[model samples]
Target chain A: MVTEFTPWQSLGGGVLIGLAAVLLMALHGRILGATGILGGLMRFNDPADWRLRAALLAGMASGPLVLLGLTGQVPAVDIPISNLAIVLGGVIVGVGVSYGGGCTSGHGICGNARFSRRSMVATASFMVTAFATVYVTRHLIGG
Target chain B: MRLLTAFAIGLVFGVGIAISGMMNPAKVLNFFDLAGTWDPSLAFVMGGGLLVAIPGYRMVLGGPYPTFEPRFQLPDTRVIDRRLVLGSGVFGIGWGISGFCPGGALPALGTGKPEVFLFVTALIGGLLLARGIQSRGLRTKAST
Candidate 1:
């Protein structure tokens, strides 16, 4: 059966995400862009910088862990392929984030908010590519 | 203060993703698979994102110019030209095929799933290509 999300549940999620992003900005003056955070870690070595990146990445990873630990409600995942395909998929996504100048969060959230035209184009591109890829892989090519 | 705040926010963001199920790659993949068993949870996720963003937006706009630099530094582009179209097309293709968009991917990495690693690699490759094209003066004419 297809899982459905209620408006309130979705809104609750939004409020949390927004609050997190805004709180980060208000307190640290930083935008929560995953690519920039990860990219910064890759490029820089300042001790001070490492902490934020580590924490940001950790928080993201930990979210699911906490849920799995607490609720025992694992999200359903159904990739009908070997591990190789999944790994390849990850690499492609990483490269795309780099080439796109930001990930979905950076462009979709931060960029769109600032009325950035590039971000709009980038986000749209992201969605379209995502749609097309799924169609080709799952339906057309049957990967 | 800033560092602490950033950390706190990051934690909250992570929790939100987890609770909302966006942290699960399977959920995301399902959303992309319209033909198989289409999941509409992502639409809620997007809606939730907008709800948080729209208000936060006003706060930023109403405030004094940022003393610590703006959280959002708008890209300097104005036109809806070729570079924009091509870049977007490439990005969309990747997203549709993999079901690992940026926000969804970051949280997934926390799962330590091997797939996250591979998807990330491809995402970086795409970025490099864009950078190379820009450096070669094949610039997109859409700047703020």
Candidate 2:
């Protein structure tokens, strides 16, 4: 019923993301963890740090424009879940990423690449929970 | 110069997300749907990312410092503690529910949809609240 597997596109996008991360590290010696950047911006104490975070966020916000330019139209985004689900998910994700010290980008991408043990464990923990949660929601509860 | 570079890199990251179809919550959710419509694009995305990152990190870290920055500000904590596991586990539930991870969600802001705003607002609130609790816990431990 849901067969949306664009391996080429996914791989291309991933390569770009990897390039971004690597470039960030090469240039600024920083990890390009999305939430970490946002969190730091929220609680920023340094002007220099705040500026860089703001710039990156602004760049991310320009995604639609970039896509519009590339594809001549922006693609429609599908949010399959309910609004309540989204809010709840958002809050939980916020708290979890904070306590976890990273999210997909940080622990999954950057941490795993560096072969960090803590990151690997964190990634596994999250992935297993994600799989279980989906099973429970889609299969068991049918949410 | 540093800020500009960061902005460019962020744009590149965002474009990658858009192209990879990671911007779609439905598609992302399908990745977790094993018994249902299981989309394996997420795996390819991660694999593609690692293919570049693994080597890129080695090249960059091999240097004493970054080209723009004076020192590499990396996380030093190596201890895989309870907080990491529990927190990540909790986060995964949210990811499973909404199909929106922080990286994916941030770029989705460009869509200017209220739902995206709502989720991001809730996310920020959650982050602040968690930080508050953690800091309080730290203070309590110190006092004890």
**In terms of DockQ, which candidate is strongest?**
2
Candidate 2 lDDT score at position B76: 92
**Candidate 1 CAPRI category:** acceptable
What's the i-RMS of each model?
3.2, 1.0
Q: Kindly provide the TM-score of model 2 when superposed on the true structure, using C-alpha atoms.
A: 0.97
Q: For residues A1-143, could you state the per-residue lDDT of candidate 2 as single tens digits?
A: 38578999899989998999999999989998988998998965798999999999888878777898888977456888899999999999999999999999999899999999988998999899988988998999984
Query: Per-prediction RMSD in angstroms?
Result: 4.5, 1.1
Clash-forming residue pairs, model 2: none
Estimated TM-score for each candidate: 0.80, 0.97
Off by over 4 Å in 2: A1-3
- Tell me the deviation in Å of residue A5 in model 2: 1.0
Each candidate: what lDDT? 0.65, 0.89
lDDT of 1 by residue, B44-117 (tens): 76677767776786696567654455453444557676655565565566566555666667766666666666
Q: Global CA lDDT of candidate 1, please?
A: 0.65
Tell me how many clashing residue pairs each candidate has.
Answer: 50, 0
DockQ of each: 0.47, 0.82
